[model samples]
Target: MDCNEYCELLPACADDELGAAESLRLEQHLAQCAACTAELGRLRALRAAVREGTTYHRASPALRARIAAALPAAAVPAAAVPAAAPASRPRWLEWFAWRPAANAGLAALTVASMAFGLTSFMLQDSPQDAMAREVVTSHVRALIADHAIDVVSTDRHTVKPWFNGRLEYAPPVHDMAAEGFPLVGGRLDYLNGQRVAVLVYRRNQHPIDVFVLRGAGSRKAAPDFDSTLTRQGYQITHWQAGGMDYWAVTDASAADLQRFSQAWRMASGGTP
Candidate 1:
């Protein structure tokens, strides 16, 4: 394929949507061509900018009313439609059926455009708030799965060893039965696009998920204060200690999460 064809294929390559053979051909072409590579870079940069820089706003009530007024009322269902089409149909519908391949291509392009627009419309959160929201999502997922603690034990040793070999970094597990925040168990979880370990705990019958992951860029010793954020009615507290990042999320109050973080920091020798 020529540079123009490869350039058209750049988006599929970036999205990993191309078949193996087509991807191989495009990769080979990219290796020899600088212009195509630069174009791909620009495309990727634009996508990143759209994802990170977009501020999304919901449609105004007036716009929604206008759209509702313009759309046809619901009448016949698709299942109730005739099997054979009538002789007369919309001119635009016939044009769409002229070339099946071209119509399919247009359909795919329309879907991609919609997906791009929707992604840019997603809520933009600050880094800290984003982390808080992520932990809340993970915590809720664990509860929904009914397997928050895969090992299902109160013993810290059992929970700690369960994470061995499964994770590159061993998360510190402690039984705080005396502190009223007993260790429920430990399970593997994902956060910030990487697999990490989670130590489950219970506070006043509420499940608290303490996600332990390797520290990203920040190496500073964990600060004394553990900032708390509430998202979707879940309280999240994040801190760094022992070269590891910790996120404790629960439906409990922010004060309860704060207390849990303190108890955790002290138990793990993370307290400064």
Candidate 2:
């Protein structure tokens, strides 16, 4: 199977949801493809880390008793008392015993509390946030390298055509030379198991690298923005537009990158 096809099944494969035949096909491909194997390792590690960090807690007996005591007296059952009960024992004390209504109320409260806690945990531990952090790291690593783009050309015509059959989707390639950000060149880069087109451009002296990948969801006209400063002292802005994820990495200030991104959106007919 090709890398694209293998990626679609990786999530299912990790969950062991694939049928025997499909699982075998993926296994065969993984045996030959080192990149996919590495990706699988990353995904598994991420899942393990998130799972290990999640927390679970049970309500204490004292807390449960307190909650039960606050309910209506009719909702509680009578506690058992011997015929020779202590003369000092109060009759009201017998009604503090647990009842079916109390149990059901406690169970409902426990479920609601657990659901809220789990939702909060997942929002903080989302995989998408982790993946975005990794993308920023990759961009930083590429910036420090002697060569960022595999192919370097000044012409958009030359750069755009280079990715013809290399990827499943046509990446948005535009010339913003008139608006101060000019197209420099392009390259082939792999992100999240798919081969993506990396287009290089410049805004004044700052170098902005736009990494484009396929598989963005149905809302293709809007650009999604994410910003991070890399360890190498470069700033990265990422977004998705036209069914593609765009990561714009540069050493320039955020305002400049924002301007460049706006121009790019207009050029590509995508909403700002």
Candidate 3:
């Protein structure tokens, strides 16, 4: 199968959810294609890291009790009333009986709880996923605007130093010319709620955007290759390595992107 086909099935392959025929086809392709092989390696490593890093915590008794208390009472206990009870109560008894102010307070608390849960889910990334999504979004935006970089240069030294005080950390920049991908330039962007440096590069006619940001938390033990196709036709691969989050996005074939990622891992002193 071609690279685009492979890219489409990669998430399934990584999750080992591919059907037999598809799995065989992908394996056969990997055997004959060095680039595909490299990509599979990166993806496998990323999946492992994500699995290892994911943590599940049970809610504390006190917290659970609070959540339960916030919910409207299901039914009033017999002990809460006299033997003789009113027969004209509304079908939706809880809503009808609740004080207006109490009902409003409960609605606000429910909304706040949902918002907190969503925010927590997004922040669960261990650098890799965060960086990858950032790069993907930036690339997609740049492609739509037809502007991918602020400063264009081939020299790593030139691009690296350009971010001097613009960012909190100096993003590691390298020229991969010998490997068929050349450094193009760099730009500044915001990702995961922080300002970041974006290093641009090219593989053949396609552009690859790499996002570099400060190590927000502890270093993840491996790369996280979260891939997704943008509405603008670019595929994004995001991960973390060497305590820095890196997200690379491009319209280049999946095999080419995988090759770039493998080369990047080697150049960065191995994944994680």
Candidate 4:
């Protein structure tokens, strides 16, 4: 591929979105073209700067409820459904009455499209990807449900002991306030078919969940022991240390999560 084609791929490369063959081709090009390599570096630096400098906000429950209430169909929430006529008809019934033929066709098309999309997801989503997705979902659910921490404390002494009898294994917990990720609390969570220990930490306003799964070495390992997983705009850092698997999930930038992961491993006496 020419430099222009390769240049167009810089963003995807930085985002880790390119497929294997495409990434291989891009890597080969980057090995030879100094200009493209420099450009890619600049692009990555810019992306990092933007993420570092920007602040993201999660929608409140009120706002989310309002938004959901305004949708016509769950499949196509953005679709504009015109107001139906008639003096006294419930909105739900009116939705069906309005443009019956067109709406039916749209619904059928939406169902077919969704089926194809689901099939694609099933084909592409490996066990590791599914685990990442579950981690992200659990993180989001904890925040929304306000059950992030069962034992709320910054001291490792108190938080570490709280999980003594709650889980099958003792998860190593440490207070890392000095390292910038202060221990917020710990919670018992169900994941991967067993109860796992979750250590909640905070970097500024972002909550980082360090999910510790015991006996991870027995499971099929990923291609890389240390890797980044992103789903639904959240970043997950998976690392194996001291025979325990750690999956750190957060809404913060990948750099921040990486730093937190490093500090956590150092404090937990587990070298990744």
| Leading candidate by lDDT | 4
Residue lDDT tens for model 4, 119-172: 545445466775775677667767765889999998989998898888778899
Worst lDDT 10-window in candidate 2: 217-226
Which clashing pairs does model 4 show? none
Give stretches of model 4 more than 4 Å off. Answer: 1-124, 216-227, 270-272
How does each model score on TM-score? 0.54, 0.52, 0.49, 0.54
lDDT of 3 by residue, 1-272 (tens): 59878877777898889999999888787655534554565576567756665444444556555655666655666688777874455787655456434655555567567765775575475544444544555566566556678888999989999999887788898778999999989888655556678888899899888877656632432357544434246676656776786667788887788888888888888852
Per-residue lDDT for 1-272 in model 1, tens only?
78777878999776668999998898788656645654565466556767677654444556555544454433345677777854455556544343433434444566567766776556444567556656666676567657587888999888888988998888888888888898878888666657789888899889899888888632322443446777778887778777788878888888888888888778877662
Which stretches of model 1 miss by more than 4 angstroms?
Answer: 1-123, 217-226, 270-272
> What C-alpha lDDT do the candidate models reach, one value each?
0.71, 0.69, 0.69, 0.73
- Candidate 3 Cα outliers beyond 4 Å, as residue runs: 1-134, 217-223, 226-232
Question: What clash pairs does model 3 have?
Answer: 132-238
- Evaluation by TM-score, superior candidate among 2 and 3: 2
lDDT of 2 by residue, 10-113 (tens): 88876668999998999898766646765665566556656676555666667666766666444222355455754465668657555745665676678678
Comparison by lDDT, 2 against 4, better one? 4
Worst 10 residues of 1 by lDDT: 217-226
